[model samples]
Target: MTADHAPVRGEATGGLFSGTHAPATVSFAAVMFLTGFAALAVVPTLPSAAQDLDGVSLYPLVAGCFVAASLLGGVLGGHWADRAGAHRPLAAGMVLAVVTLLVSAASTSIWHLAAGRFLDGLAGGMVAVSVNAAIGQAYPDRLRPRVLALMSACWVVPSLVGPPLAGLVTEWWSWRAVFFGLAGITVLPAVAVAVVLRGPSWGVVPAPSGEGAPRPALVVATAVSLGAALGQYGVSGWDLRHLLCTAGALVLVTAFASRLLPPGTWRAERGLPATVLLRGLGSGVFFTLEAYVPLLLITERDAPPVVIGLAFTGAAVAWAGSSWVQGRLLERSPRHRLVAAGAIVQAAAVVLAIAGTLPATPAYTAASAMVVAAVGMGMFAPSLTVLSLTHSPPGRQGHASSAMQTTQNLGQIAVLGFSSALFNVFLGGGAADAVGYGAAFGLLLAPCVLAALLAARARSV
Candidate 1:
């Protein structure tokens, strides 16, 4: 069967693997790596940026601006690509990202850093959509799950390491070095794309129908994501006002998203509705638990940072490996079993997390809980992604992908925000010094419950 997007076989040109990567695969990975670079690398160095700016006060603005801009970029990039073409948008965005990295490295003031981060994030958003859409078009159906899983793994590996390396550069050399280093790392991906995927086979974007109203929903999702992100940087300067802002942000986000999705989806009707819900719930529970477990180990259980880092490493690697394995293993499984088992495993991990907390030893408890959470998350994410894409129509892949990501962004905000408030209510001022360390860990159940509910809906779907 001929593909609507690719009229010619790219095999005639430089293949993704010329030796290793097929042209499409290589190009897709290149884009995914860029997305990972921004998501993972720049975040940890914000403190150094704050220090370099010579005032701690500007830190919140620095982080928020980057996130806000990225949100906007995601909307623009997706919409523009749909109107223009993926190849040009991705190519131009990469160049822009590279230039911004240089600007980030050379920044002399907070404003400069903010500008650079914002630009960098903008490029990141473009990369996320184009690369993902490319993968959807390029890979065979049987291989798509693995390809997406690989993309997820690339994100996980770099995201885990980018922060620490950013911190190290800031500590030993300068935060600027992290930016410069990222700039240098980008060359490979950019070069690969230019060399390997430069043929006529890849299609530009199709024009939007009518006014493209679905895009507004993505913007709202970004606001929701921004609200959740704001909570993490609160140590720099966030409070009740920020929290309240997030609440309002989420309402708008939800309302907007409701419009973009297929009718009755927000309510999780059969088929695609349930798929979107699964995407949201899978991510929501995983991160809600993730955000707090380390703190529990360090403060409540009194484990050291090194041990905590190891616990995280375990979760990350496990997640990555599971994503890879599922790519190979689940090709034959019914979407129903694959999706349902992934959900059940992830929920079961939350139960395991509860059990881990029951143990008194911080080291043992943290390790056990993290392993469970990581494995569960690993199983859930890629599988859910596959099911979501599986049911999407060819032309609607962009809309569906955006909807999935949009749901995830909202999930992070709504589930995480609600969980934080729950944590404060359950374990407050005692956690003022403690940061709600242990009680925060308990919020894993919310997402698990949500996921289970969605999984049931998925079965019927």
Candidate 2:
């Protein structure tokens, strides 16, 4: 089909695994699974890697590098997909992923490991945007949600096994083994992804002229990525240098980041703009909670590592299950309404988390917050993705997907920074630990509320 005349729904008959869709579907899922496994597995090994390299003081920077690099990756991948096709970027990202794994495996210094992580994040961002763009180009509107849900499902087994497996490897062998092993296992899958993308079934839709122009978007994305890294590092401490870093980050983002998003995104203009805004808000709320909740359980309640790990597992499972429900049972529901409902559910989860900060509440109450928030995300996140694709002008799905990824990263950085500030302020003011925790959790409600209020604007007029 021509760009302007692209079909709203795909012409494929039957389910994802049936007939012509099977190869692309299976290949994409395998890519996601490997990606998910590497992500989950690598995280648990960071502390050991940092300590062994004698970079304990710079741990936050090491961890934050991946997120920073992903912003650039997203923009690059999106533009590449728009100009060429999703397949090329997707295949390139897979290859880059393997290369990054090898880089990390061979790291001899803390900075080397950080560089590897940044490269991996870049690869991840490319892969993520390419997959979403592929879905938009290849699948019809009716099938998008299910495809997204299946992608979510691909992460489940990885979530269940990755960390523990990495932990065992780290404990039994060395942290490097995790990287080497991930690289070894993913090589074939990466090749498979490349081979699959070579097939003609993936609908290689390139954006029309003037629609997917790159120019300043890539530059803006780079600045925003740097700002995010600075902001994350800034919030790791409350020193004067960190404070100045934080201020600088805000300035950078405020100045250039909007150029990368839809016009009036900050104002939550109806349709695509609001959809992008909601992605940020919803993501901010969930990531903020995800970061702080485990810290609360560990420090305040003295919860064991096992308990924290289980909470993460539960959250992953809940996210997958909820995504399945939205894609399967509620497939006919309006996307905007589902988004609003999800926001409301997320608000409730935040409240539960706040309540858990009290001395009288059991520790599990706080831990359950992660799962609850994930449940909300399962519904909210995919609905937004579907809506974004639906509302995107024909041939511009890559641009839309890029905007969503950009804002999602910004949301995490902004929300986490604000909540961290609140937590630090309360603690510095001599408040009890519970009060500080309460303040941080309470700050998350604003985004949840804003997202709920603006959810309707995401609907296509």
Candidate 3:
């Protein structure tokens, strides 16, 4: 088929898993499943690992470091994908994951665990951006939505199985066993995928390297990582030096963030920039609110672990179903309208969360709110991705993918950090824990509203 006449979802000709691309599609799905499983399975074990390594005080760093390091990884991955092809970086990221898991598996100290997580995040970030860029390059425009939806669906099985399996492994054997087992299982499949997808016809052609000019992208990427790390450290401590660290982090972010995003991204310029900004805004609110879900349920409502688990599982299913809905509507509906509608749903979810704080509210009220909000995430996340890929000019898809991922990381950190700080302040001030939860959810409503308002800008005018 010619590039001008491409196959789309629901076509009589073929689906996403058909033709010469079938092997690559299957390989991509396999690796995605592995990565998703690893990502979720490891989370529930982190508390045990932290206590074992005496890193309980620095527990937040474990997750924060991953987000911080992923920024650099995303930048490097995008540059490498553009300069060479997505295959090399994707393979490297997979290998890097194996190595990092080994490090975590062998860790005897808190710093070692942190180092492993940081490297794992870096590798995972690279893998994610490269996969997005690769999909954009490999698939026809019409099929992109279906492919992205498929990627989201890959998380469903992981969400269902990872936590319980990890808990069982941790209880029966050891946390290290989980890491070692994942690393061992991922190696052969990752290597197999790399070998299968090494052909030049995969559609990712290398861009010309500029003649001896300094790599501005690299500089900006490094600055973002440093800023995130410094910011994390500042939040971890309460001393004077921590305050200085916060100042330094802010300076780095202010100075370098713009260099990484689209020119008018800071101003929410229409089209690509607005698309990227909306991704950040939507992700920021959802993730920040997600972090507090378990806390509110456990502390305020006395929900059990099984109930908490059920809430997350339901959200995962809802997210997948919503993604499927968007894919089916790709031809019938416009992206901007879907995004705006999704954002409104997100806002409504927040309101439900706030309402859940009432003493008379049902026990599942907060959980229901989270699941519904995830539907909003499901609707818009893939749509924005498709927009980001389509809006980019030719070889710059890698850069566009990197920008989206970077903003996502930054959004999670910044919004969650701010909301967490607010929650802590309220708690310290002797406010009831329920009051703190309410205040934090109230604060989250602003970004959700902003994201909805900006969704129109994601469309081509």
TM-score rank, highest first?
A: 2, 3, 1
Index of the highest-TM-score prediction: 2
Worst ten-residue run, lDDT, model 3?
3-12
Q: After superposition on all CA atoms, what RMSD does each candidate show versus the true structure?
A: 4.1, 1.8, 2.8
lDDT value for model 1: 0.64
The positional error of residue 206 in candidate 2, measured at the CA in angstroms, is 4.2
Query: How well is each residue in 298-324 modelled by candidate 2, as lDDT tens digits?
Result: 889988898899999999999999999
| Alpha-carbon shift of residue 248 in model 3 (angstroms) | 2.6
- lDDT (C-alpha, whole model) for all candidates: 0.64, 0.89, 0.84
How far off is model 2, as Cα RMSD?
A: 1.8
Clash counts for the predictions, in order: 10, 1, 0
As a whole number from 0 to 100, the lDDT of residue 186 in candidate 1 is 86
lDDT of 1 by residue, 1-461 (tens): 35542423222233335443466675676668666766677777888777878857767667655644554565666555555546666777788888889998898888888788878867776666666556555554656676777777776667678667777878899878888888888877777775555665556434345524245544565554454345434423236766566555555555555654556676788776787777777777777667666656666566777776777667777888777777776656665566666666766666655555554544556556666666766667666666665665454455566556656655655666676666666554454533344455556566666666666565523
The candidate with the higher lDDT, 2 or 3, is 2
Assess candidate 3 and give its TM-score to the true structure: 0.94
Better of 1 and 2 by TM-score: 2
